[model samples]
Target chain A: MSKEEKRLEILTAAMRIMHQEGFEGFKMEDIAKEAGVGKGTIYEYFESKNDLFLEMLRFSTEQFITGLENSLATGTDLESKISNLSLFGSKFLSSHLNLVNSNISHLSLPEDSKDQIKRYWEHIYKTIESELAKAIEGGEIKPHIDLKMAASVIIGSLNQYAFKKLYGTGLPPEQIDHQAIARMILQGMQK
Target chain B: MSKEEKRLEILTAAMRIMHQEGFEGFKMEDIAKEAGVGKGTIYEYFESKNDLFLEMLRFSTEQFITGLENSLATGTDLESKISNLSLFGSKFLSSHLNLVNSNISHLSLPEDSKDQIKRYWEHIYKTIESELAKAIEGGEIKPHIDLKMAASVIIGSLNQYAFKKLYGTGLPPEQIDHQAIARMILQGMQK
Candidate 1:
């Protein structure tokens, strides 16, 4: 594998370890062993433990965004498009449940992570916001609705619910039906 | 002062330190100094650092819960009650903003601290949920609204927004406009 390919392989292995062992338990030796790489090879890709962990988080986020963009682009109608976005959120968050959970507790984020998180949600909000605005303009939604608050509320609601399912053991994730949740929110925002 | 009074004095000082310097930066000596008590006095009240910290968190949560219950009891009409709840949320979240921000950071939470967080939030959710059901039954809100989701959504949105504000500097706290936010949320949920 090329150097870049090798680096990606290493990160993938590190993420799996993080998922199974928790971030604190993640060690360089474990990643090296999991990746079938020499400890020296791992260093070539990441300078320190913190650096490797942060990079893993960034990579997961990038992958999510890229996948979201591709999924969103596949639909033509507004309903399908919105459904696609929601599905993307559910499935992606469910799969990367650990990393997302770790974002609040395991990762030592840099100053820039704030911008990255805002942009990430802002992108999701803008996408949904544009659709909601269009629907209102098209008379599909109530014209008087405050689109900004609606967008923030919807994004915040689903994101937080999904997060609780993924991170919070207090409530079992199975009890929450995503379609029911989407319907209630969409209905509340409906014309 | 009696031993109990002195202990309460030490806890009050510890809370201030935790609020200002965060839980990680809190030291027994600093709390003792702030409380104007000898270091040995701290040991008389608490068995360990973990015990002291947990007691502080529990104490603050109790105060918050009590204040909210009082607000709920005082408001008679549904709209006024919901409005009071929103305002209460805005005030409570913002007041403890620093301490909450400190706790969510990856390195900040010790493993033992996790259960305390879960219990605290679950209690808050249940309290809100009960009020939500009462509002729905009393015809204060549209009967069709999902009380559980509404409670979760409102709390989650405010929390996330607060989290963003804490991490995303350059945005002054005044920019948040708590009253405006409360109006937006209550208006959206209004019949």
Candidate 2:
């Protein structure tokens, strides 16, 4: 595989290890084994466990962003865009349930990792902000809407459901109706 | 003071110490000083620092619930209810920004403390859930609404703004327009 593909492979393996072992029990040797690569090969790509975990988080975020962007690109109407985003968010959150739980409850993460995670979330918010701006410019959503607050509301609402499921307070991920949620958000944003 | 009043006073002091010193720097002696009680007197009420902190959290949550219940009782219309809730939420979140920040980032909290915190949040969610139910039953909100998800959406949206302000990513608390946010939530929930 190309260098980029190999890096992606390593990150995927790291995420699996993180899911199975959690942060406390995570081991680099396990990651290497999961990646089907030698220990030295894993080290060549990542300096340490922290480095690998951080990169894994970044990689996962990028993948979500890419999926969202693709969905946004295909939808011509505001409703479609919102629906696509919500659906993608639900599926993504469900698949990354362990990561989301760890991110919420794991307190031992280093400061740098925490900052990186915060920045990644900020980037996600910005992406949604731009989408809202486009909707407003197209007269799809109300022009009077507070873009930042609106974005936060959309993301927070969607995330609340994901968090509930992860915390075992809500229905299983398969039972959540993403389309219904998208409709509520769209209704809230309408002029 | 009556025993309950004294407990409230002590909890208020604990909250103040938590706000100013954060969880790590928090000291029982400081709380005692702030509460204007002797160290031994503090032990009379709370068994330990952890117990005091947990009770303080529970007390704060009860206070919030009381405030919300009073407002919900007074509001005649759906709009009034939503407005009152959003306004109260904004002010409460602003004042407790430090507490929220610590709760989100502090990982060293004992498991029982964490469980207590989680239960506090669950209590808050249930309060909102009941309000949503009342709104629906009174024909204030849509009958078809998913009460639990809707409540989560409202709380999560409000919290997102608070989180952003705490993180310095959004407007200061005083500058946020709670009415606008309330309007958005009300609009979304309306039939």
Candidate 3:
């Protein structure tokens, strides 16, 4: 495998271990075993457990962002773009519920790791903000609407729904109507 | 002081300590001192630190709910009622950022305590859901709108904005326009 492919393989293995064993129970050796790689090979890619976990977070975040970009490219209008983005977000959040929960509960993670995660969130927010700006420029949404607040609200509401589905006895993630949610947000934003 | 007043005093003191020192650094002795009560006096009301913390959570939740109920009572129309509730929610959340963050990070808190907190969230969601139902019946909001999802989105969006104001350095909590947020949500929910 290519070096980049090998790194991706390691991250995938690490995510599985995190989901199965949680952050407290995570062990590097177990991850190596899961990935069919030697312990030394894992170390060569990551300096420590924390390093590996941070990389996994970054990898997942980048993957989601790429997916969102792809969705945006295919969507022709403001509502379609937002609907696609929300759907992607819902799927990503539901699938990574364990990782999100672990991040919430494991407050002892290093400051740098937390900062990195925060930066990733900011990136997502910026992406949404840019989309909203495009809608406004296209005269699809009201110019008076606060893009920053609008972006946060859209992302946050979708996250809340995804969270309820994942952790609460609410609708299953697949059953949620992403189009309906997008329509609601569009109604709120449109002139 | 009356019994109820004394209990409120203790809870207020506990909340202050939790905010200032966080959950990990909280101690009953310090709370007692802050409340100007004997250490044993605190035990008379709460069985232990965990009990006291849970009670604090319950106490705050009740106070916010009471405020929301009052808001609902005074508003003459559906839009006014929702605006009042959203404003109350935004103010309450902005003021209680520390408590919220502590709850998110302090996963070591007992399972029952966590469960109790979750129950409190459900209670709040139900309150919003009932209000939405009232609006639907009055033809103020669309009947087809899902009350559960609508409530979650309203509360979740307000929460997301409050969080950004509290932590994002974008705006101070006091500067956030609660009414604008309420108006946006009302637009989305209105028939």
Candidate 4:
């Protein structure tokens, strides 16, 4: 594999260990084994375990942003856009939210991570806010509906429903009816 | 004050310590000082520091369940019910969610705590599910909408919107347009 691909492989492996074992439980050797890399090779990708932990946060955030942008891009209108986002949210949250939240709240993280988390939230919030604005311009929904509230509704619905599914015995992410949710959200916001 | 009132006061005090200082950071004397009670008085209510800690979880969860029930009780119909719930959630989650989640995930918590959390979730889920079921029976919404999905949407929306307010620069909970959010959610679910 290419160097970049291999680097990502190690990161993913590190995330797995962290996800399963938390911040202090795993070792470098554990990550190396999980990644199918030699011990020394793991060192080449991340300077230290702390580095790998921080990178995991960055990697997860970056992955989410990319997924979020892509999710919003494919739809021509609000309903389809929300549907795609719902699907992405359901899939992405169950797999990665635990990793993200755990790392963000762990004491070992620096103050910078809190700012990163805040900025990450703001970035997603703004991205969705603009998407909603565009939808309003397109006459997909009511003109005067509070855009910030609308954005919160959309983001919140995805987060809570995904969390519910994760915590409760319910449909897997793939089986969730995203279109229904999207339709429900849009139907409410429409004039 | 009455005995029950004093007991609750102590629990609230313990929660403050736990909330500000985390699981390990506070002492019994600190809690007593926070509560304006003798340190010996704390032991009269709780067996030990661990007991106080565990009670904080139970106390917080019980408080949430009570608030949730009362919030739903004031509304005679679906729209009013959802609006009331939204207001309560936006206010309560900002204060209690971090504590509940931190305690639920803390290493010192026993496996039994996991069961309690699950039961707590299921209780709220069923409570809201039944409330929605009543709404459908009353013809406030469509008969054929997926009730489980509907329930998830409501719960998820409240959770997420509240979280957004907690993390972002936005309206304080009291100022949030809970009615708007309620309308949006119900509008989508209605026939």
> Chain A TM-score of each model, in the order shown?
0.74, 0.79, 0.83, 0.83
Could you tell me how far off, in angstroms, the CA of residue A13 lies in candidate 4 after the best superposition? Answer: 3.3
Judge the docking of candidate 3 as incorrect, acceptable, medium or high: acceptable
Q: Estimate each model's TM-score.
A: 0.72, 0.68, 0.73, 0.79
**Tens digit per residue, CA lDDT, model 4, A36-141:** 9999998898888767877887888888888889989998777788888888877876665354432134233456866777788788888998998887777777
RMSD of each: 4.9, 6.0, 5.2, 4.6
| Chain B TM-score by candidate, in order shown | 0.75, 0.76, 0.80, 0.82
Question: What DockQ does candidate 1 score?
Answer: 0.27
Per-candidate fnat, comma-separated: 0.17, 0.34, 0.26, 0.39
List model 2 lDDT by residue over A1-191, tens digit each: 99989988988888777655554446778888999999889888888876776677677777877877876787877667766776676677655523432223123356787787777767777888888888877777778677777877776777766566545354565567776777787685223
Better by TM-score, candidate 3 or 2:
3
Estimate the TM-score for candidate 4: 0.79
Task: Select the stronger candidate by lDDT from 1 and 2.
Answer: 2
Write model 1 residue lDDT over A1-191, tens digit each, in one string: 99999999999999877666654457899889999999898888898876887688678877876766765577664445545655666566655533542124212356586456657656655676676777776665556665555665555666666655555643444445655555545554222
Q: In model 1, how many backbone clashes occur?
A: 1
Give the lDDT of residue B73 in candidate 2.
Answer: 72
Best by TM-score: 4
In angstroms, give how far residue A183 of model 1 lies from its true place: 2.8
Model 4: lDDT to the true structure: 0.73
Sort all candidates by lDDT, best to worst.
4, 3, 2, 1
Q: Lowest summed-lDDT stretch of 10 residues in model 1 chain A?
A: A99-108
